[model samples]
Target: LNEIADHDDEGAALQWLRRNRRAKLWISPVTLAEVLEGAEDVDAVRAYLSRYGWQGIHRIQAETAARLQRRTKHRLGENDAWQAAVAECMKARVVGHDDAFKRLAAGYEDYRP
Candidate 1:
């Protein structure tokens, strides 16, 4: 998302997104909020992100995120915990450059380039 917002076409994350355009990707509500919070043009960003699927946080996901946070000693912050929880609950791979995601036991694809 940051890559897209910055228009970093050469970024590995952006490249991966382009390559997987047809894949069943999903975005968490937490992620949507975070992205929009920092976006200079919220409407544009929202419109751009509308193509992906959105999964709302449920009780199980919240519980999972709490457990993950507790187990990690709060290393995975609240927002990231939610993200990880959503991905874990969906059995999906988390694609991001955040090193903190590595601290949790979730499937992760490091897009740090």
Candidate 2:
């Protein structure tokens, strides 16, 4: 769920992401891109993940992409589509505060966290 703006941990956003990080986390390539892009230091990611290890970072693949694409509505906003693409790709319940992503998530009743 990380984004460029998420770098600013001035509020609840930071708490939400860090609170349950010990739990299994799913990530699509897009989400990976976001975290990498948002980070100020590359080594921090490696250092942070080193403890959790690769097994903790469950990467999503094409199955998620196709499923999300199939579930996505044609009328959805561009950002929403992208969001769906990533969430769907991971088959992970999205952790988004945005209205659009929330709405899209609503339609994915089968989505598992």
The candidate that achieves the highest TM-score relative to the unseen native structure: 1
Quote the RMSD, in angstroms, for model 1.
Answer: 1.8
Per-residue CA lDDT of model 1 for 1-95, tens digit only, reads 86566666688877887777777889888888888887777777788899888899999998988887777554677788888889999988788
What is candidate 1's TM-score against the reference? 0.86
- For model 2, what is the C-alpha lDDT against the true structure? 0.49
After TM-score superposition, what is the CA distance of residue 5 in candidate 1 from its true location, in Å? Answer: 2.1
Clashing pairs for model 2 are 64-88, 64-89
Query: TM-score for all predictions?
Result: 0.86, 0.49
lDDT of each: 0.81, 0.49
Tens-digit lDDT track of model 2 for 1-75: 243234455445456656666645554444555667767765665455444312122335344445555764644
Worst 10 residues of 2 by lDDT: 52-61
